[model samples]
Target: MAARIDEEITFRKLEILLAFLEAGSLARAADALGVSAVSVHRALHSLETGTRCSLFRLEGRNLQPNDAAHALADVAREVLQTMAQGIRSTREIAGYAADRIRIGSLYSLTSGTVPALIMALRLRKPDIQTELVLGSNSELLRKLRDGELDATIMGQPEGTPDIESQLLFEDEIFFAAPAGSPYAAQSAIDLAQCSDERFVSLNEGYVTHDRFRDAFRVAGFEPNVVMTTNDIFSLMNLVGGSIGCTLLPGRIRSVLPRSVCLVPLLPAFQMRQKISVSFLRTRERDPNLLSLLAACRSHAAERPLASG
Candidate 1:
């Protein structure tokens, strides 16, 4: 009868060996593995004992793998890759794969590009169902980061590390006032003229709310906010009544009633918005996510989006 082998090989041992080979020293290998040097020493000892062969020789500060250890690298890598694939497959079966995508966007996109994109998606893949969430930039990004939203079309979020983005459009921000107002008659008005003037602005956390605030600051002034509201319609109502002037996007020109006029900012300060599609890069390849991405790209290409 053949002698039964009692040695047990493990993935951890393989990882340690690989780390050592690449780092060329126990201290460096430990750092790469996020462990201490003493832990690395123990792992190497375990691996050496299991194989019943000398794998490494310490010379100066370097740990050099001998021939027997060097020869096992290819096999170790193949095993690790196989294990990773298995884990990925398990995650897919658990509904972590692209089975569904939850989309979020700014309210403005809902009226035009977003609706067209949704219809186009349904036409392309009738069986795919999507959940659309509407909110301002800050809320959408919060949901996106919290994993409550799969993707969102909002102004570019600053300092988001794990999020990925693709730019779709750039639009100028304009000053909007009721039609026939002296401010409306001018092609452009200095931002400072309104420094002490009453204004209507979006509720806190809205993307444009911040943009308008920043513009005021840049112009060396602060706005006299007469009112703040979440609904754009309400803001429009206030502007129409001449209650206050508010910042608006140029795209709304054709849509807004004749009672509203969009004028350029003095010295022409623009928010230069870039409507983008954003999602976690790790989630990009999910099938449902892939579908959503395709829809956004197609819609962007077909629409008359603002350029540059």
Candidate 2:
């Protein structure tokens, strides 16, 4: 005989069985559990198979549960409640029941703004533990909205309602070119002048990519495209290799290769990316979140280099 407790008798199946028992019909159970009627039937069938016993009897067009089914449903309900309580107790012990801050940030800020803000936050709250999530601007904003992250450091997200943001700093955009390129020797270059030059850029969904495209719009022409990459480092390497020129934030100059030059764009064509610390409005009163926001404000007031 198969074991009574086997992998087939999963927690999900148990939940389904309990729902089926309470609702008295597969269709009703499916509605209660937000699943298809067929899925409810399948889980009940699997449960009966795993237990190696008859759980239901087909009475005309309907399924009527036997004594065994009722007994198992009682046990399953108790088991689910116990498991839920165990999870809550574990979270309490792990300090997650309190205000544990989870901060999200741009991947590019990991080596710079993120570390500085973290260090400053720790200084203020030595006992506080933090979780840092890194992603693109859009991903971070979504996570923040879903409560997965308490706050995020990124370029200010536009058209997102119900988020509160504090401006951290403005980073100027520059035209990056090969060191030996003729344009590198000039103190500044016009974006229109590079209209015909092949360019390397970040793919869509990145804030920088949108900014790069907008710069071309200001210059009144489309950019000659060659390659698109995910990270700024790769884009910089492409420029260093003389493959193409690209636009990048001025702060990135601290890490650029000597073979790459970051030339300023003329004032008329200059673009600036505004970095901000953002959080859901609902989390505004959270002490840990407030502390983190204070740290960000302090860091920005110091006017530190974007390279950290």
lDDT of candidate 2 over 1-308, digit per residue (tens): 97357778999999998888889899999999999999999999998889989999999989899999999988988999999999877754433434366888876677678889989988878887788887778778888877687789989988867998988888888889999999889999988877679898988867788889989999999898899987788888999999899998876766789999988899888888888999877667766777888998899889943421
lDDT of 2 at 9: 94
Considering every candidate listed, which one attains the maximal lDDT? 2
Q: Model 2: residues >4 Å from true position, as ranges?
A: 1-100, 304-308
> Each candidate's root-mean-square deviation in Å?
12.0, 13.2
| Cα deviation of 210, candidate 2, in Å | 1.6
The ten-residue window of minimal lDDT in model 1 covers 92-101
Off by over 4 Å in 1: 1-100, 303-308
Model 1's alpha-carbon lDDT is: 0.78
